[model samples]
Target: MLEVKNLYKEFNNRPILKDISFTLKDGEIMTIVGPSGAGKTTLLRIIAGLETKDSGEILIDSQAYDSGKVGVVFQDYNLFPNLNVLQNITLAPTMVLKESKEEANKKAYELLNRLQMNGREKQYPYELSGGQKQRVAIARALAMKPRILCYDEPTSALDPNLRKEVEKMILGLKKSGLTQLIITHDLQFAENVADQMLKVQPLSEG
Candidate 1:
């Protein structure tokens, strides 16, 4: 299970997240929903270790994740322009995980297959469409094999046709039993995939 306690964050004396707390179980898809600027993204960043919390504890399966064990899928693909699809996924594992090039390539190939990116390995980011790049982004995160997956308004930036494709991919991950925490304003995405939903409202706003 993942547990968060007394989370707090501030910037320039303005509170972004205030005393937020929650727990999430493994294999569960928990979504955080609310209006814009409600601290949803801030909370996810803190949980992902992309941002520092003023005070609180984030734990995953009894291990502290102050450095963050979760993987985040940003709205933008966050891909490197110079790398091909396959290289983007393979580089991190062999480089950061210190696995052999052979071993990393094998895992990368498997993940590419699982991510339905067959025959597209040589494609550059500029060559692929937005939805496709986002799909690659998702695959790259999965290749890392994180303990928790966090998505922030994943499909919000895509057009409807493009959005459905990304939506289907996320749904596919859930069907295969990936543990996820999503923050989105899109209610349909939550209704279609979330195992549990929590609406975050500030202490005085509600």
Candidate 2:
């Protein structure tokens, strides 16, 4: 289970998140909805250990939040512009996890196939469409095999048709029993994929 209690965050003395609390059970999908500046991404960053909370606690399965235990698919996809799809996905597994090149390539092949990105392995990020790039990003995250996956603004850059496709992909992940946290402004996408919904109200200044 993932549990966050009384989380607080501030940047340059300006509070972005305050008193945030939530829990996500294993294999559950949670969608966080809020306005653009309401810190939805910040919350996900905190959970993924990319950013630190000023106060409170985050626990994953009763242990402290560890970077190795969570994976994040950033809003911009964040794939390496110079790396081909296969290289992009395999980089972290080999560099961070120290998996052998052969093992990493095998895992990347499986993930690419599962994400329906088989033929695009040799293509760089620029050669792919927005949806394809996002899929590569997701594949990269899954390559880490983290216990929890978090997506920020996953559908923001996609058209309606692509949004639906991504939505289906998320549902597929759920069926695979992966615990997920999605931060999206798309209500329909949220409704389709979220097992639970969280609304992060804008923090009021005193």
Candidate 3:
């Protein structure tokens, strides 16, 4: 379970988020939806440890959250342009986790197979479609074995068909008992897959 308690954050003495709290149980999908400047991404970033919160407590499984326990897939699908899909997915496991190259590659292949991205291993990011890139990004994140998986604006540039693919993919992950957090402007998409919904409003400027 993930619990965020009374989170507060500010920049330049201006508040971005204030007194925000939520709980996401394990094997659940929680989607955060809001308009622009609503701090949706900021909250996600804080959870992923990409940004600092002025004050808050983030706990997973009733203990303090570790950034390593979270894996984030950015809006732009931040796959390395120069690396092939297989290399990208296996990079972290080999380097960060110090797993053997063969072991990392084996795990990457398994993830790719699950994502239906088999045979695209040698393809680079530029050679793939938006949806394909997103799948690779997801596979890369999953390879890290995070306790909670997060997506930022996952359907931003996807066509309707591709969006549906994402919806199905998320549902499949849930079946495997993965905890997920998603930040998206697409309310309908959020409704389609989220086990719970959180609506965030922008903090009024002082």
Q: Candidate 3, residue 185: CA error in Å?
A: 0.9
Better of 1 and 2 by lDDT: 2
Cα-lDDT of candidate 2: 0.91
Can you write out model 1's per-residue Cα lDDT over 1-206, one digit (the tens) per residue?
A: 78989888888777778877888888888989988888898898888888888988888888867343677788786898899998888778777778788887787778778778888889999998777787778777877778888988887878877666766777788778788899999888787778789788654442
Q: Residue by residue across 43-92, what tens digits does model 2's lDDT show? A: 99888877878999999899977878898999899899989999999999
**In order, what is each prediction's RMSD in angstroms?**
2.0, 1.1, 0.8
True-vs-predicted CA distance for residue 14, candidate 2, Å: 3.2
Displacement of residue 200 (Cα, Å) in model 2 is 0.6
TM-score of 1: 0.92
- For each candidate, the alpha-carbon lDDT, in order, equals 0.81, 0.91, 0.94
Query: 1 or 2: which has the higher TM-score?
Result: 2
Model 2 segments more than 4 A misplaced: none
| lDDT tens digits, residue span 1-206, model 3 | 89999999998999999998999999999999999899999999999999998998899889977999999999998899989999999999999999999999999999999999999999999999999999999999999999999999999878877888899999999999999999999999999999899999988888
Candidate 2, run of 10 with poorest lDDT: 158-167
Ranking by lDDT: 3, 2, 1
Clash counts for the predictions, in order: 0, 0, 0
